[model samples]
Target: MGFSTDAIHAGQEPDPATGAVSVPIYQTSTYAQTELGRDKGFDYARSINPTRLALERSLAALEGGKSAFAFSSGMAAITTVMMLLKAGDHVISSANTYGGTYRLFVHIFQQFGISFSFVDTSRTEQIRHALRPETRLVYVETPTNPMMEITDLEAVVVICRERNLISVCDNTFMSPFLQRPLALGFDIVVHSTTKFINGHSDSVGGAIITARPEHGERIGFAQNSAGAILGPMDSFLVLRGIKTLGVRMQRHDANGRALAALLADHPRVGQVYYPGLPDHPGHEIAVRQMDGFGAMIALDLGSLEAARAFLNGLRIFTLAESLGGVESLACHPASMTHAAVPQEDRQRMGLTDGLARLSVGIEDLEDLEEDVERGLAAMKS
Candidate 1:
């Protein structure tokens, strides 16, 4: 079947006993065992839950990967991947990556002896020169958080393979429906299903899908041992959201294009960053690797005061922290998402005080554009 078909039906089947079309939430914490060791497939909820397993199966199929694992949040998925390394190991990651990921690397993992180098993975040469003998992984986020920067997955994967490093891609911005990094030779793909995957914005969840069974087994072990697995209810919600991903993505792409075009000509706008725009720095590569340019866009309003005026004037777009919802959202990366990163580092990554990230929604283009115009009008003051 196709991506949409597989999403709705891959691991999902009518309940054998009830014949319910939707996967019922198996809310039990434990399963009965015919023998001391085992009975059916499930023994405990933490190790495995039928609903979570179904969602994992869908994620695997969506990403064309060997196996998938669910976690409490996206950071949990990332932390599990970090566990794949130990003390004295080093990893190179995109400097424009998510703030939470940056915080985890610098404050949490660095204290444990693992080292990291923040470089422009979009410029492969930076990654090439950052390699150390201990470097075991190269992490990247195409259309990186806030900056909307694109990294060539094939190029980075080749570098990782040649150096015998694990290549992980944070595919949160471009969900599996838009781009599948595994097929492009990436070893692992991670996502915060809280956004696009669980499109409803009702649940907070995360997943790790590995291109190889070996990587899957390793991550599965961490999930089972650390026990940050998503609950049966949230897993069911995420599974429900996946069924409509194809349709939702279509609207997102359309809205993104409309908004980017309008903003490009707006008198108040500065540095519009949407990959779908022909003038965007990464437009050519995006056209090559992605099926759609997605709804996420970022821009600089020329100054922090101007950005505040625009943010305050928005009526339709919610001023919120998270994205990938049915409704539009606007956030300030310098203060909201990347606030934890030191000022100097955030500046180096191009997350300036004037930068505002917009998570354009599936709303009508006219309404969204009018709301954007409201923001621009506020800037006139």
Candidate 2:
């Protein structure tokens, strides 16, 4: 089956008992058994749930992985991945990853004796240079959150293979429809299903898909032990949201291109960062790895005041956090998303105060353009 087919029907089969089409949410906390020791495939909800399993199987199929694990949130999935490492294990990650990821690495994991090196993974040599004997993993976020940075996944995978290190790519920005990092040889692929996979802002969830059985079994154990699994209800919602992913992403792509072009030409727009743009630094590599240039776009307004003025003027674009939804959202990364990183570190990664990340949605192009124009107009001297 193709990607669209798999999204809707892969792990979702007609209910064997009820014959209903949608995968039924098995909401019970425990399952019945014929004998004291005899059991069915599931024993407790923390270890497994039918609905969450359906969603996990769907995500694994989409990412071309052997197995997938569902988590309470994106951070939970990330924490499970880090649990694969012990204290003193080192990790190399993209410098401009999601703020929550950075927070977990420095504030949380670092206290446990694990260390991290923040590098520009777009430049493979930076990743290569940052490696240490204790480095157990290479983490990447292509079209990275807010900044829209891209990492050459194929090349990074090659480096990981040669170094005998694990490679994990956060595919939240460009969901499996656009890029399959596992197919490109990444050991693991993680996603915040709260974004594109859910499409609606109604549910918060996360997933981890792995190509190898060893990795899958270990993470599965951690998922059960940590008890951060996604509930059956949210799992059902995410699965429902994914049924329309193919169509939603198509509209998102179109709107992203249209808006990026509009802002690129605007007098107040300083620099637009979008993979679809030919001049974007990682355009060629992105062209090779991703099926499409997703809807995430970031732009510069030349000054912090101008960016805020534009954000305040927007009517259709809600000034809020989170992205990859059906409605447009605009936010200042310096204050909202990437604020946890120290000011000096944020600046080092080019996260300027004036930088605004736009999650273009499936809306009328003219209306969306006008909303952006409202922002541009407000920034006028």
Clashing pairs in 2: none
What lDDT does each candidate get? 0.92, 0.93
Top candidate (lDDT): 2
TM-score of each: 0.99, 0.99
1-381 per-residue lDDT for model 1 (tens digits): 899999889888787759889988999999889988867988899998889998999999999999999999999999999989999999999998899999999999999999999999889899999999999999999989989999999999889999999999999998999999999999999999999999988999999999977888889998999999999999999999999999999899899889989998887898899999998888999999999999999998988999899999999999999999989999999999989889998888778899999999998889999999998898865
RMSD of every candidate to native, in Å, equals 0.9, 0.8
Q: What is the C-alpha lDDT profile of model 2 across 1-381, one tens digit per residue?
A: 888999999989887779889999888999998799988888889998999999999999999999999999999999999999998899999999999999999999999999999999999999989989999999999989877888999999899999899999999999999999999999999999999999999999999999999999999999999999999999999999999999999899989999999888877889999998999999999899998898999998988998899999999999999999999999999999888989998888888998999999999999999899888999867
- Model 1 segments beyond 4 Å from truth? none
